[model samples]
Target: MSEAEASHRAIARWTSRVIPAILAGVAGYGTYVVVDRICIKFLYQERNQPAAIIVILILYFLFLLLSLWSYIKTIWTINTDTGLVPLTRTPPSRASSKKQSRRKKEGDIESQPYAASAAPDSDPNSPGLERFYTKEVFICESDGRPKWCPDCCNWKPDRAHHSSELGRCVLKMDHYCPWVGGMVSETSFKFFCQFTFWCALYCAVALATSAYSLAEIIHEGRPMDGHIIAAVAISAFFGLFTFSMTLTSWRYIFLNVTNIDMLKKAWVYQLAIQVPRGTPSTDKYTTITYPLPEFSSPQSPAAGVNGHATGPTSPVPAQENVSSARDQMATKTFAVVRTEHEENPWDLGWRRNWEEVMGTNIMDWLFPIRKSPCARHDVVESEYAMGTLVNTIKERYGLDKLPREGSGGIEMRDVPRESRRSHRSQRS
Candidate 1:
């Protein structure tokens, strides 16, 4: 590496190591001051309550251990599953290579579709095609190409984003947090949440105990101990910080969204419909932008792939004809449009989403030792955001299903009845 590049990497390594160490040192020192200096040395000793002091010390140590475990586990998970390691396709086995060579010699290889270009022939109805259609292959919508990460020299997986600081793609990345000295991602999210919770809990407990002692000192008109003052102030500040962090983390978990998801949504409109170059001209078609209704009126002209309208209909077509035409139009339109936010396929529903990331076992939910269901699988299968609510609304509107492309491209006005009810409920 060049001197400048080497210097940059050295700085990153130093910061990543030093920041977390400093945070840990501060936390450890504050805990020691509160429990040993204030709670035990002053409060418990003054009251001659040796048993209470011992119990408090034991609990303090237990919580401190748990916090350390969570922090370490979060860091470990991020390191292992950040998608930084380039994944190249495995080479064909010798037997397969020989067979391919024979086929080539027999002049039959030319007729075979390239593996990169064709769907698997073993199963014509393979779910792979559906995955590609849904943008789960991490293909770029701008030009129908796979999104390549130059830093990693690999194709990015769905929902994985490149982190400039880390110089790699992180799967389902939330953000690079300086406080944690690492990127928060799919594998580490649960642990990160647990860390925040434990940190806040520890700080709050310390603050409560220290505040009590401080109050006693004031009531007796005695000078407060310097250690007690320091503990109370540090605990109060960190307690609020960690508590807010915990709340924010849980909010995103509940919504089945991430900070990155919100950021991507801000530019979702840039993904426009792209028509194939050879599409036939339709004089009577309508070009509708995405976020269209689940079902348009029969009189509404079919939209072209280019978001243009064709000429007016000659007459009322049969119901079946209208449905078929609409489906065809939708399919063509969807094929060309970028799938960035086409559907939050990762959102299964509030309950399922929570269960997937937080674990079904109540104990596991409360702790960070056990792996979450989502962590077991590399790829996360998702559905629409608020899927249950959306389905209920669609059924109430006599719409049998969600939009063909999952609720990403459709408009709220297309389903006004559901939108109105949602609005009223929100207002109330």
Candidate 2:
């Protein structure tokens, strides 16, 4: 198999393992909950003590904490090893034949290349460049030939596309997010971490509070209205919380892809469409001779292949360099070593806040969106952004109507509502 395919397979294999583990954990927790319920009944009926509830609550919290901790550690690595943060340096090196040093100096801050490209160099009458940055894949140039692949969808932004992990094209594409929910955005990551802590605490508190109340009811042989109200209130709170959590997890699962990886996938798909089966990409696509936009010397190219120079401002020549530069090598993406400081995605201040409040006994209000997936407004805003992306794609790619040769469409208002709805449902 080609290297890229092999790497994807490896990721799939590892991710599959996580799926089973999560499933098993869920099953285990269900079993525990059931057993605890039964035990509580027995203890109250025969032993006649409130301690039973307390004991069960402790055990339940312990298990919840354990599961949450494991998930946090695993997901955190994706952000750390990948370019989720500024990535002052390159990301960590994966196992591969083409090994190279991928470090960077501290304080070399950078953002997505597209973000910078969104600003105009000098034209006053010209619209802001951001209008062109789309979330869907499609050809921008009318002269560009229709190179469609059944396996992949057309992305309008050219470079902005989707990663399989993230089910949709992301702005300033990075990589797929794999946390139980999805991409590790500044907002989402914070919620994910908070969700972990709060979930454990919530579970513990509910369990303790419930058991104590039940014990009192059993011992007193009376149903107090206040006790019953409290129970109902707790249940209501949990139901709402669970509803929100489910939404967050669903978002993660559907769009777990990143901006960087989106381009990589789109690039590979284009190459695949152009090349015949069994054909390999040239050395240019496989090896990195320079750093990426987020890590290159201000004067240097974004990256290179096999020691060849690839500048930052310009893309590798599309036609001439196709043969010698990016020969069909099969590998589509490369991971490089990056510095820790450059990798801070949470904004400098947020990371500091995380370090400070993490594991501390602070007022819960201090971290409002401390649960996974953060808040609903953030989710809604992301959707709104996606809507804009769809419109951009329609403008660039000529929407449902195929583009005429040598011309690309770029009218955002032209996209059909049904198509956008269809894509949204696909994600849902």
| Per-model TM-score on C-alpha atoms | 0.61, 0.29
How do the residues 77-176 of candidate 1 rate in per-residue lDDT, one tens digit apiece? 7666653434443434445534444544564332232333221222223223233334222223332323334333344555667665665567677887
Candidate 2 per-residue lDDT, tens place, 244-328, comes to: 6545543432344233433231222211011111222243221122112322232212222122322222345556334321222
* Global fold similarity of model 1 (TM-score): 0.61
> Which parts of model 1 are misplaced by more than 4 Å?
1-9, 50-55, 85-140, 150-153, 265-343, 378-428
Error of 2 at 108 (Å): 15
**Which regions of candidate 2 fall more than 4 Å away from where they truly are?**
1-3, 6-21, 24-38, 50-182, 202-428
Cand. 1 Cα-lDDT? 0.56
